[model samples]
Target: MSQTVYQQHAYRSNQVPPQKPRPEKTLAQRLLSAGQRMLPWSRPTQTVSTRTAQVSPSQWQKMKTIAPNQECFWNEQTLEGLTGNIWARVYLIFSGLGKFVILYFTPIFIVTLLLTSLVTTGRFGLSDWIEALWAYFLYAIFPASIIWGQFEMYNRSYWKPKLLRKLLDAQKKFELNRRTGMVTLYKRGGKVRYSYPFVEFDCILATTPSQQGLVNYSLLLAHRYSGSMHGVPLGVLVTPHETVAEYYRLWNMIQCYMDVTQPLPDILLLEEARPKDPTTAAYDQQTGRNPRYWRDMSDDAYAEAITQIEAKQSKMSETGPEIDIFAKAS
Candidate 1:
């Protein structure tokens, strides 16, 4: 057979085969990619884990007034429990003033400078205006800054005792377990400075009779700015309080409130209070230690133990002691 035209054309052509059409990007995918490109600095937001306050055994003993079994809670100190050194307090005072100026006054000063430049129109040069502004800030605003620090100190002193009194009065109502004593939270950035002081209370809420396990709840009495202000000498100051009864009220009146959502401490005491299974009870009676103490046992051993206990329970249920059923029936 002679070489056909088809074979000649195929041998002469060197063009590459077309690739499968690139898959079309979905709208969501395209938008997400665009957003990622636009926000180069953005990263996934992370939860900052806070370290709980650590109390020494002696400190704990000194802080706690009630016995281990009693439900009454008390923290002997007032809210000014975490008073730092004088130098530290001075640092905080200056820091707060600097923050206020940077955040609030800087913008106003900038706008004022711009307006003055526009209105004065060559009556003063930029240097002259800048000098005058510096003078005005130093002479006029500096005193105000000091006053601001003093006002904050005064507000803290005033509200702290009132808050403590409220807590003391509320404590008379229910049996509360002392969760923490005079905890001083440190601000982020690894600095050993006073952030705030708080005490936590844990209470076993009376659950409905139908419920099995005790309802563990906690209330955090912390000092934060209440956003309300009191008129002081120079200016109004922010009030700080626990805000417990304000947000949570009964019959339109302030009432003691407990937080329901915060993670409770591992309630070993409550677990001990719970009625144990017969097998576990027997084991506890023999060993005089909680059955939970054996949680480190091998998985196989644990499984075997549970199985044996269940089997014993089933056997007992099947052949348990009975009354005279036939006589009762007759």
Candidate 2:
């Protein structure tokens, strides 16, 4: 087979061949850099950019190489409200009482039935003990039904109705249109909350240290000049990393997905949607790119691919090259 997109770009981060430190900034560049720090010390990180990512060739290479890391971060059908050029996930962490109902309460009832049946059947006196145990279990359901009714009434009243909607509305989808070049955000009810051209938003990445001192990262998109707290979520990386480059990789991935000049990032989840995006369709036709390259991989090969992507990521710069997003905007 001919060389694939990733194969052509794949270089171990360890083999990244030395890069020189950025040259001293010109006076104008220095002022721009200093301006980002003028805000309060608590001002959020990656919060003062003016344009969306304009991913360079090397950044694209790194992003495509690491694309597998992001495949697990998104879901296909969310809220049943999205289709076409969509990225969505569970927007509300505690969307409803459903987890308690399905995971905890139901499991407890099943386990209790099994355990009581086993313990109460250990032949103690009465010849009809098996029948009696089952009869008592069935008889308990009347009181259990009352308890369930009270729980349901309580769950549906007051503060819970807002949360209960999340059983179906928890998904928040971003309508990223490469053709139209817009990024749309949805509300908890799956209504359009905000929409803007992709270039009008800035990528914001924030991380907090756990008690274990490991840092976890979150990706957000905010209209430029918007307050830090106003950012909409762009999913998060569950795996911990030592530095912020993973944020850049993710940002680059978004850029590739939106840029009409480039093909879509080669990730398994996007395989089916590849042909639907204009630029991706064109590029695939020109290169005869295998649509099933990712989906057809064996489980072991997929695991190895992830290892390689991470290995490339680990040895690279802790922070990737800086781009003056303002300049790109100008």
- Candidate 1 global lDDT: 0.31
- State the weakest 10-residue window (summed lDDT) of model 2: 39-48
Candidate 2 C-alpha lDDT tens digits along 121-188: 76443445556556645665444554455344433442335543445322646566555555677765
What lDDT would each prediction earn against the true structure? 0.31, 0.48
Off by over 4 Å in 2: 1-169, 226-228, 235-242, 312-325, 328-330
lDDT of 1 by residue, 185-208 (tens): 333222333322111111111112
Which pairs of residues collide in candidate 1?
none
**Candidate 1 C-alpha error for residue 34, in Å:** 70
How displaced is residue 239 in candidate 1, in Å?
A: 19
Error of 1 at 45 (Å): 38
Which candidate leads in lDDT? 2
